[model samples]
Target: MIELTDNAATELKSIIDKEEKKDHALRIFVAGMGCSGIQYGLALDDDVKEEDVTVESKDIKIVMDSDIVGGLTEAKIDFIDTPQGKGFVIDNPKAASECGSGCQGCQ
Candidate 1:
């Protein structure tokens, strides 16, 4: 199952509160075609499809499509703050694959 770091949860909660989507769930899914395979996507949605797998962390409901669940089994969502700015990142071990450019992987 996917997991969210404390900072990630707090940041997401703040966003939801600001956007007034308290009634909605955070939808995380695979989108686009990454060099390795797939990329991640996040959105605020109220509908839970029949093929979705939902997990609750830090009082936040996170939903993901069954098809993409396996690839995110051990993923961790984290929020990072630097002098430049702050943002969310996913530390997904499953996503650590060779980019086909002779490089080890994108870390």
Candidate 2:
């Protein structure tokens, strides 16, 4: 199952509150393919299609397409605040394992 870290949930809640998107759910989807395998993107979406799977974690609703749910199994969403920047990050072990030493996108 996909999970969201405490930091992620807190940050997301803040954004949702600021944006006044109380009805919107966080949508995760395959954004593209990289050397590390599939890359994911997150957005606030109010639309839920028939093929979508929705779950609640840390009081946040997460929505994903059924097709990509399997690939996201055991994945964790985190928020990082480093000197470089701060943003949401998805840690998917399956995708990381698919990465080779030559991966440039992950670097």
Off by over 4 Å in 2: 96-107
Q: Which ranges of candidate 1 are over 4 A from the true structure?
A: 101-107
Q: Rate the local accuracy (lDDT) of all candidates.
A: 0.86, 0.93
Candidate 1, residue 95: CA error in Å?
1.2
TM for candidate 2 is: 0.90
- Model 1 lDDT per residue over 14-40, tens place: 999999999889899777766677789
Candidate 1 displacement at residue 42 in angstroms: 0.9
lDDT of 1 at 88: 82
After TM-score superposition, what is the CA distance of residue 13 in candidate 2 from its true location, in Å? Answer: 0.4
Looking at model 2, how many pairs of residues clash? 0
lDDT of 2 by residue, 1-107 (tens): 99999999999999999999999999998898788778899999999999999999999999999999998888999999999999999998877666676777766
Each prediction's total of clashing residue pairs, residues at least 3 apart in sequence or on different chains, is 0, 0
